[model samples]
Target: MEINPAITFQHDRKVMHAKRPKVLIVGAGLGGLTLGAILQKSDIPYEIFERASQVKPLGSCVALNATVAPLMRQLGIYDEFVAMTKVIPSIQIGNENREVEFAMTAYFEEATERFGAESRVISRPALYDLFLKQVPKERLHMSKKVLTTKQGGNGILIRCSDGTEYEGDILVGADGAHSAIRQNLYAELKSQNKLIPSDDAALPFNTISLVGQTRPLTTEEFPFLKKEECQFVRIVGNDKPFAWSTFTTKQQRICYSVVQFLDEESSKLHDSFRNSEWGPEAAGAMCDEVRHFPVISGGDKITTIGDLIDLTPKEYISKVMLEEKVFQTWYGGRTVLMGDACHKLSPAGGAGAGNALQDAVVLANYINALPLHPVVEEIEAAFEAYKTDRIEWCEKAYATSKMLQSVVDKGIKPMLVRFMMKNMPEFMKRRAAEQMYSSRPQVAFLPLDETPASVKPTHQRSLNLRAPVEEEVEAPAKTI
Candidate 1:
């Protein structure tokens, strides 16, 4: 007779399961959904709350490159994500006259090969739906706005607006820039004189953008849609402080955005975006202003940004203020912030969404390392490590975002930036691309993706972390 190996493995799995902690996530945007998905795979219990009763298509498009593609694969959504996106081979930059200034074709191609993954763009709504599907319907609560949160009963607790309450060992504020949890946490920290001076300041923004995706069109209507490669184009205004971009997608539709770099006086008025609704109505004025902006729709036909605006459903178009800020304080007393809630970034570099997803991954990795009933010190240590591992990357992305923003802005600085980008030395440009593509973090608990790449990825410390397993002590020799 032999002991069963399957039984022994199951016993070990149960031991691992006993160390899992219950997670309470606020917000169901990309970050929150991503964390929930990983926890689902890790067999850790968690719940997600969203203020909206239904998920809305409020954004233009999100580009996923090598940065988070491996994690997407680990989560079992890579193929589906690829199918929904159009690979971006290059980005064509032009001026108000529609004259081509420069193109990043060679750079994009080289980076794609070296990174072992193609950069792909998908409509934001489509992306939201993809990640939302990974989370169980029961675990996601709609229209559940968190009113307040506190630590009690040997754990954390949250009270919803509807008078419902929940308890968990950890609370993750993956909510957007105007996060209620952050507000509450800051208020508490301020009372105790522990809040950082910068963290207490208002969220400053200097650019306002109008983003939308058009209804599907025929090849005859938009010839660019017929092309296998994405027609990615960016245009800088000659006189006005404006820049706009367009991308052809696999859905036979065009995703576009027009940005207005506000002046100092204008920025002061819209400096704090604490209470503002984002939707078509808020974007109506900006739409009218940029209606005449030119776009290359192929076939020598004249197309304006307004034409695409008309093709898009009113509900899908949105006006948003681009805010750039990285809060110094991330976690305090079982409450931690991730994504836009912690590091708000401008969309110029297409890094905001990717960073948010990365935050979810790194954070989930730390949460998975928690013991079944973790003490306060253990929880703080985990949050500190999560922030330590992520802040440097976020700051780098923020700086890159600012640099890209300058290239499209109206000023001598912008002109200089454009010149440098057009004439950047080959080695220098290659080094920059290498730095950008070198960070490809994956889920630590899942099997690693050994698919090789030319550039070595940065080491993720969380991959080396694991919860301590209780050692089996040998029974004392029988005294009887």
Candidate 2:
């Protein structure tokens, strides 16, 4: 079947441009790599710098919401995603023994069907692989950690850990929460006396995450476990911290985490996490407590639960901080920031990846427009337009994630939570499901008029023709 030419044009315009703008992308994680893939389709001279020596499968699972589907499709990796991951038709709130409290399958299905998109659960490493494959190997520079970035009249210069310097028309910091570029920007502002003397660092939320894979279990043995569902088994009322288990794969691959809210007293202890390790002894004790409840251990399947898996205790989770005013000044001269660097959203709504991917898409459109016009003002305008269009969506997602986390960490009893779950009206359950599954923001791009002429229709077609002519010219001088 023939693909639409317009779609092809939009996807390949970057490769056809005469002179692409130099784009420096920091970090090679999902957000950074996604941006790289989008830039690959356009005529954008770009490089990706990753701190790690090699890309590793870091996280367990990621929830790909409906909003991310279009971006994935645009990147030409949507089909591969579908094939590699499982579509979570619904989210189920259950207990330790697997007693369903509130089920939301129908609501999720309806929303997806209506929106022409589906939510998928995939291993983070798998998704990263997809993005990495789309980006050219030569363009990805691993083990090059960005130390600092300086913006001058001409362009931006990035200094790396190895003393190498990279000059580019635009620098994008797709780095995560601890962004070096962000810190540099703040330092610049501080030195100019534009900000206060007080420490601007955010207070760390006291929480710990323990992640591990479990042996496969039969559905019959684990009666409450659904085949394709992402189960959020909340254990409330325990003296310990709030805990939950998520099933990301059909083969019983599980991700279980417990979050403890540290009190003032507990926070004072510097080695509190080391002191309270959820090691084999702790896991055994917890298993014993859970085994008593059929719902948690799945009764007969209790034997299959792996021995206390790797424990990541007492790691400080960063709280979401919104720089509502600072976002207005995101584009400083030739350097810009995207993804978490531009807007750091809490992971509660699973919108970070989606939002970051959208940033990449919009930025690519803007950069592709540069070669045609080659105007500094136009480039800056494009960056402003990107921020204008995306700031609200990012802010909202961050706020929503924070709100949901607050509710889950309220210290309600497991029995009471389960009771509430069991008694929740079908309609209410559906509404909540819709809220979680349907909250994805629509993907929007900067107006085409805002796009530089280079990526615009006239210039795109011209560049496409020039390619054929150049090939012909090179082909000529053949022995005739």
Candidate 3:
């Protein structure tokens, strides 16, 4: 498959509207950017509308597993991706005092062996920069906030905050958890009495975190901080659900996140925070909240959360609540949703980004499978297939994320399970990895037999975008 880095097109409204289907994607996060990359590769025309003027991810770091590697390689940016990230081969779990409670070094190797790519950690901004590099400037309209989407005659119409309306054969919501597109899509469906059971409420979140990248901590200051593939995991206690993760990125810098679960109080503080300005005072308060939390390095070297916070430039850190929500109504008509719009996830399992990219892969495959100048029926069927392929996993992903969060939080039984995971047999650990990654979604366009020769089995499926015309996949009816 040929991956085109960018495709520039002059705006010819008549030709585009009369010919092939055009996709209008909301939100330029990972999912939207990934979809744009796929469509560009397929020579499909599309536009990405982002709320932000520039595509800089809010979080400090993003974890990429083997599951999405093939697609990355297919994009022909694997080398760049590799250069921008570091393999996180070791995950050392510890207490507030930094005393080692349990460690898992073998799982990373096993995952690489079983899944065909090494798990990596990268600066979130760098990741977005890579995607932005591939996407043509003409195709991405920054600061164009999408307000609503409605079904047009045979396509979909989108209204933006800037008093603009755009039309496309299909509209996709990659607009994060609190998606305006998702809300409008569901509202349209509800008006027709066709809305399915959806997870509308924000995930019952009690966790608030501040994550940022800072100047690298030297090996002399923190021994394992510079070690290859080292990922430090710190859990304060079960009494209060709090955890800290510190790891290295590409540049001479480290990224850290401190999360505190507000289970004791009403989510009011969190809910109230949504509208408040996240200015200096708020960031400072969040930093002060966990400044004294101990983060252990090893035998003797120890530091508090404040130490790293003090080193980090004030602008790098982001404070936000971790949410986990899964919606049942993924699609109706030509409007469909992907990524955080449909399924939100906790940061525990590091599954959100991977899952969103997977959504791009699967959804692209289905859309690419369409015949040239497809009718409304074909577009609708593609949307149906995409939803059917993803809804179950969407729900399961939310459950799985919380399940891992429990282990990280270590309430009671989770502590024992965490212990077992720490010293588990190599064979058993690999088995767990095998099970965990067994059903990862694959792009329909990628060949089962990879191009650049994979050393390990890619254990992922490919969608046959170009199928026999005689055989047609029945468009699934909308589900409850």
Candidate 4:
């Protein structure tokens, strides 16, 4: 399991010089943007490079759990975060035939009492825009597709597609699941004969997803969509092609994600997702496979995937293969990976983006703790510490999200899942949720700093962890 302790750091020892470390982050997605926000607050100099031509919102919605609220607050965006989100307190699940399977309530209400922060959901664009508000326009470079990196005598040079070059003390890969930076890092390790064959293995896809947002649903059309702002809905089938979750909000349009489990028939389609052009034709073809499946909103109303597809803008409908992957290697020398670059998960618990934001905050903390004008050696050490603090939690979240996704696949196991989940006592449910909800990661050195953002409360009152008498120290990293 030890990965490239085999990949040696090729520092230009003779050319090394001292300078205040500046971070160059690749990808302006949640992880990259959030890291920029934190570094800005700490007065750390950094630049973010995005391949996209503009900062316009591109994706759908994202979920926010108790784990990320403290970091948002510290970045001074908590009120803006709260203002645009809606809290979903319960979940309702059913079969593809519209038969009720199981329903869980008070999970969020209880989670709130347990975590002191609310479990909420918001549009991805709003979050991206909000995070960008703090990032200066000059700091964000657009359409700068990363070409490669070279370690010169003084520092690392990042070459972009337009023949432009940028130099930085450290490079962070936040380029997401298909990360170009991640590929380059591994490519270097591979060139050194240090990367295992599996290091560049393909991500597995057991489910095909079509997610989009629709115009707001009328109460008469779907009561469930409005329940506590948005009823977190999940639907599966015993013998059908698809399963789904209606994600959030009555005030805004209904955001939904319908997943078609891979089967003998659909597996034929899965292979071509990477090559296939996504548009109305693709979405229509996907809907044709599961148009007969029923999505129940309440006791009286039921709709089909075809119905929802008709409501969605063709441009917004995403036909993607849901994947779960945890890379064995996350860093090399002054370059390191963050968020989806290292661990890409199924959007099962709606926790993928939240975990990415957590990675940004934790990584920033480690880097910021270094003495003024830290060396590449110090930056590399901080990267190791960052991975140590995050990898176990990332793996745990990965497994949990996979299980949640499994429940929505078209299989008989969902029947057993319904039985087990429904039979559990609410207190047991609360305790289980408390265990999951309480896992908020923090900067070990933050409490010792004399900054306004440093002393911000964690919004984690339920764990009842005894206040440590002295500064927290690093222990052996947890093994997954």
User: How close is every model to the real structure, measured as TM-score?
Assistant: 0.93, 0.72, 0.86, 0.84
Task: Decide which is better by lDDT, 2 or 3.
Answer: 3
| lDDT score at residue 461, model 1, on the 0-100 scale | 92
TM-score of candidate 1 relative to the true fold: 0.93
For candidate 1, write residues 214-263 as lDDT tens digits. Answer: 99988877778878878888999988889999998888879999998888
Greater-TM-score candidate between 2 and 4: 4
**Which sequence of candidate numbers ranks them by TM-score, best first?**
1, 3, 4, 2
User: Which candidate achieves the best lDDT against the true structure?
Assistant: 1
| Poorest lDDT segment (10 consecutive residues) of candidate 2 | 453-462
Q: Return whichever of 1 and 3 wins on TM-score.
A: 1
- Residue by residue across 242-344, what tens digits does model 4's lDDT show? 6777766634666777787776666765677754433444666666776666777664766776677677666667676676788888888778999989998
lDDT per residue for candidate 2 within 1-480, as digits (tens), equals: 221212211223334444456789898888889878877765557999988787643444677766566566655567778887777765555544456556535445654445446677765656777788999999999889889777654456788999988877778888766667767766766676654433355424454443434444445645434545555444432344444445545445554544445565655652333333223333443343333322254444452222323222212111112122124346655567787676665444556777788677666665665544244565677677667766666666766666545434544463454456457677786665554443332213311222111111111211111111111223446586
Ten residues in sequence with the least summed lDDT for candidate 1:
1-10
Question: Quick one: how many clashes does candidate 1 have?
Answer: 0
The collision pairs in model 4 are none
User: Mind sharing the TM-score for model 4?
Assistant: 0.84
Q: List ranges where model 4 is wrong by over 4 Å.
A: 1-18, 55-58, 264-268, 275-282, 299-302, 443-480
